[model samples]
Target: MASLSFFIPALGKEPESIEDKIQLAEELKATDFNRFNELLKQVEDSSVNLTAEQHEQFRFLDAYRLAYSGSQTQAVANLTELVKVAKSEKVQFKSLSVLLNILIISRDYSEVFQYLEQYDQMQKNITDKDLRQHALGILALVFNQTSQFDIGYFYANKLSSDAVDGKYACFGMQFKLESLHRLKKYDEFDQEFDAGVATCEAAKQPIYSKIIQSYRVERLLEVDPNQAISLLNSLYQDVEQTSYNVLITLYKTLYSIAYLRNEQLDVAKEYGLSATKNIKEDDINYAILLLYSTLYEIEKANGNFEKALTYHEVLVSKQKAYDDEKAAGLLAYNIAKANVEVKNQRIALLDKDNELLSLQKDLYEKEARQNRLLVLILGAILLLATVLAYRGLTGRSRFKKIAEYDQLTGISNRYHFNNQAKIALDYCETNAKPVALILFDLDYFKDINDTHGHAVGDWALRAVVKTCRNFMRNNDVFGRIGGEEFAVVLPGCQTDKAVLLAEICRDAIAGIDTTESGKHFSLSASFGVSGSDNSGYQLKQLLADADSAMYSAKAAGRNQVATFSE
Candidate 1:
């Protein structure tokens, strides 16, 4: 909570020694930028002679300054090298912590977790009392941010119970309350809130105090509007004084939501507008969604349905973009991890080669020509085994891909579809979000297969898939569920939007160009839509209801969209 203090010494003034200067710099690094610069100058003075470890410490401090001062590129480049080559364990630990800090700021969570593993391993060798407390505090905060609340709660307790410093204790309590809030330990959170805020106040950290209060405000929004408004109003001055963009935005958003619920339309509109203007640059997606969502509610309450619809559309667009960005981050993280595994495997193979070479050398020194031949034969056999193992690995990977996707259309097959749909539905249910399912199939697929050949029918299916894919969001689940039937699961979609999307797909199907399949026949699909609002979040029930609706559409006429009704 003191900003990457796992390897930083406690603050002290008037340094009389190099160690004292380093300690003082660590103290001022996060709080007082100008003083940190002056301390850097004194450390870099020509008359002062510094040891190798001390020099590394100075570099660490310099990188910290660069990172906080908008020169993160150079800071990361320097810290990365220092993490590898620093002679002192303290400096190396500090480098790793700062590197993690930079990664977190950049929202490169994958690398943060990767480096977190390294930090976890290094913690065993670290013996400093303050450093251990800081490490626990950092772990608690990071885990909480990443939504690993149970682990965060565990570490927060450790940090708080073991902390000797009041500041560290306050930090531990702050994050512990955060974990409880996210974990939905409501009764516990209510019990802990006052103590957490009091501890932060005792430590003279109004910022942490404000953060704890914001959590209370968020909880109160669901239960007591007036109390939530009162808390938000009290929180406004502290948040403004801190000038922290994230807190400022959160405070305003909560204030607006509170006022909207309390029937103060003008005040809600004012704060909603102000909140949007204060969104942080690094993390705009989630903030924008929150701001727009509150504004949408406010507009709807004011009976300005058109403005509300516009805000709702903006909310949808922002959510899609956020989902895409999250997917890309996961992809990048997986790629990075895979690269590391490949490098480690290569090193392992080289080690085995070295071991084999040593055996061959031993045989040669013994002057056993026959044994040398035997060793060479064994080496060949080992190489053959390695090749076979590699083939087996690749073969399994190929089979896995085949098992998960429809061979003809390259979308999820029935089994994988069911699994993925369930996961999506579960997530939506957890968040109390709506979901909609669209079940459709070609109107006359059997007729098409009989009139033409299976080749043309297959081409038609693939074409339908391609057309439908265009209308789906990144988070939407599309799959081939049967011979001619397909399903699309749209999270956060209500029935009207689902029906609209189904109608669009139906039209698109009717308009598909048969020329691509080298045929001149028409195409059509019957669509059935069912949403959680009517059918609940169970996939089985949704699919069953959509199926009934599809048959109803077919009985009425072919190539029509039908919504599930009582």
Candidate 2:
């Protein structure tokens, strides 16, 4: 909370006190680059001095601004400076995460791997709860993207089990599902695939759930190509209900499968052209290539041999770009070297500071003599060592707790929830008191994401979580098990009371807004309540019963609650 202005460069005079400077930075007009650059120039020309921590924060914000402004390459250059000065695990981890994501978007895979290797080291050093968990999630995703399924699944499960928040746990579950699919463990895949689908649906993440379903088609195709086509056709209407971008990709894929089946030629032509038209030339993902490939087939079918040949060449060229091993490894060295340069710069700065202090002592403290100077230098070194040691101890404790809670929503994760709930349930059972469980799932969340986009969907999720916390007290335990699906354990509470609470939450969520930036939409959730009598409490049974009840609420109409009945 201290003023962070020491980080900003001053203008002509000493910059405003740290608080004013930071407040001014926060108030900058986000869209007006002219005003933004004017503020930056004033800082760059400022006369103010800065602490190392302040300077690091300033530089991090600066690079982030550049990335936000779409100057990604320059952002990378700016971020490189921060990396060089990276003494703080939190700062370095944050910077590396941003840089890696930008590189991924730029398809700078070579450098992504290099930074990833460094990221592994940073994640280990991180004790900050928020940063550590976020790093774990990012690490899992990056590894999954790069085809490291085993390692990906490990981190995914770690994030899911360790963090109980919705989005983060959902991502972990999604990664686990993908990793399992890649490993070809069909039995495990089948078991998790449904959960994955449910989470995605509960969370209103249609695209991800559809991808999970698509894997089943891939597996089906491996066994029977014709049947696979039939399978996709059966799901056509559902797939078409997705957002335009996702629907385009699905349609293109379906066109290819239909072509294989030697059926739906007209349908293929319709979808191919529709997908191709919707796609811009700059879109270079695999889906775009498939669209072109499909176009090649459609064109050939129409006797447009020349056009078909042209499309074929384009498709091959796009495919070859991916096969270009040389390109993938191109930037790995320079980007990795950037990490090393950071350590080198840190050492250089320390050496330079020490040299300056020694000179200053010689020039100004001659009367104080060499003995005093010697003690001064030695004392400073010892003090620095002491501070580092203290930080190390404190940081580890924070990191350990970070591992037990979801970073996104700040709730107990599945792992922690299980422990806490068991204790609570046992206490209730021993006292012969009834206990209740409430499970809530956001209704049609995917539509919010598909229509309003992910940011709004996220806002809705946080709103629901926050609302749940407001309605429940300290005695209750809440955790997010599936995406968009949350559970609360109310020890010594009966079904009637649980149902009342669930309805309260349901109505509260229904009143919340979806979007955050400007335009807004309403959101709602379905709730299910189940209870255990004086006999005992079993979490698994409660969850299953609650899920079914919740499903009934969803069927009857969302934004309502259903209680388990005999």
Return the top candidate by lDDT: 1
Per-residue lDDT over 1-566 for candidate 1, one digit per residue giving the tens place of the 0 to 100 score: 23545434446458877778777878777667798788788887832588777888898988888887899899999999998899899889878877887786576776776677678668668888777777787677667666678888998988878878888888888889988988899899999889989988998887788888888888888899899988777778878998877778888888888888888999999999998787644355444677889999999988999999999998887888777756655544444454455457667768989999999999788877656677776888878999999999999989998999999999999999999999999999999999999999898899999998899999999999998887677688999999999999999988987887787688789999898888789899998999998899999999999999999899898899999986
* TM-score of candidate 2 to 2 decimals: 0.48
Shift in Å, residue 366, candidate 2? 49
Instruction: Give the lowest summed-lDDT range of ten residues in model 2.
Output: 1-10
Which one is best on TM-score? 1
> Each prediction's Cα RMSD?
14.5, 27.4
Per-candidate TM-scores read 0.56, 0.48
Clashes of 1: 0
